[model samples]
Target: MKPHQQGTERVITSLDWLAVLPVGLLLRQVDLTGCGPTCITVSRWRPGAGAGGLEGTGLCVCKEDGAVCGSDGRSYRSVCALHLRSWVSLQSGGERIRKAHDGECKLAPVIVVSPKKIHNVTGAQVYLSCEVKAVPTPVITWRKVSESPKGVKLLEELPGDRVNMAVQVRGGPSKHEGTGWVLINPLMKEDEGVYQCHATNMAGEAHADGSITVTEQNKSKKASLLAWDNPS
Candidate 1:
């Protein structure tokens, strides 16, 4: 603030957009219309993010055109928090929505596997899993590095089965939306090849891979009668 400027101290708050919607909008009617130093509104990064952590975006109340109100988008009573929560509604005049459109915080579903280090035999069945850290449970699919595992003898598959989604994938619970399972059933010798886990959601697909080794069993016990015979 310049020496000449007075009453321009902005109000800061801890509430997120969702928590401050109903009353925060009212800040515009009184705060902006007042005849004091233009209220310079600002806030601490997401409450839970802690003292120094800042994950969400913010708004700046600039005194342009000799007034808190200006033609350049900044001239709003309220700014919808980065993602347009609520209190942000009145202070920034919906800046959050505009930002969301221009700069989305979408999380591309990423495939993460547990026990990333796995070893299997030709006749052993293997199990791999993945989850998208993004919102909206993504579609989970399986693939082979070499080729699709189609046309396999399902009945004779090692572990005697195929890896497939156990349940219809939908938006996982809010906290674990992009989560899913990848099951490899009746793993076989040819199936020893590497397998890829794919999870796709509206945002995008995330990828991860796991290597598989199929150790062949030793030859059967049958031996030829003439084997090791002394040559005349």
Candidate 2:
């Protein structure tokens, strides 16, 4: 009976006059009822008789304007449609909803599990892993950070020319998340350096660093034998 005002947009709550109007007809200030002239637009009518129906007691169907993200973490067809849903929710004793943003929701990459420093002896196997969460499914990459002879920093993508090193990336243990791993078999002194794991998406990017410490096999065995013979 009364028009609900939201910002500069007005939503007419009366639906008795809309019953006789043809579907998809746009009317402006045409007095259909004896009450007075009122501006109303009925975008379309869906056959039925209820909340989403087209019968005399049905709800008003707003036209498709644009997409909007709601505070409830849901997306609506448009602002008007969001307003209608908010009104209905309130009438049903639910919390009122508002627009959170103009576009869909997105999340940047967040590293939940980061790689840790590892200590191993040569000829042993080692694994470095990192887990990231992000929207739009981020791309995961593994890099080896090293210093050149000139003391310049160099970043080489994993498994590049390394015969003993391999990299694997796979989709999540959870939604919108992924895990990446770097495996080095028969670990050598050359593999002892810093490794980086990077996750990138349209929203943003994230990176973490981990180091590997490798000891000579003979030296490690000798130290173990010495410790075994001279336990304190």
**Whose TM-score is greatest here?**
2
TM-score on alpha carbons, each prediction: 0.42, 0.60
Superposition TM-score, candidate 1 onto the true structure: 0.42
How far out, in Å, is residue 164 in model 1?
Answer: 10
**RMSD in Å for all candidates:** 13.8, 11.3
- Residue 220, candidate 1: Cα error in Å is 14
Model 2 Cα shift for residue 23 (angstroms): 27
- Model 2, 6-45: lDDT tens digits are 4333444553333333333332322334212112334334
**Per-residue C-alpha lDDT of model 1 across residues 45-68, encoded as one tens digit per residue:** 444456675432233333322212
Error of 2 at 54 (Å): 18
Q: Clashes per prediction?
A: 21, 0
**Local distance difference test, each candidate:** 0.44, 0.74
Collision pairs in model 2: none
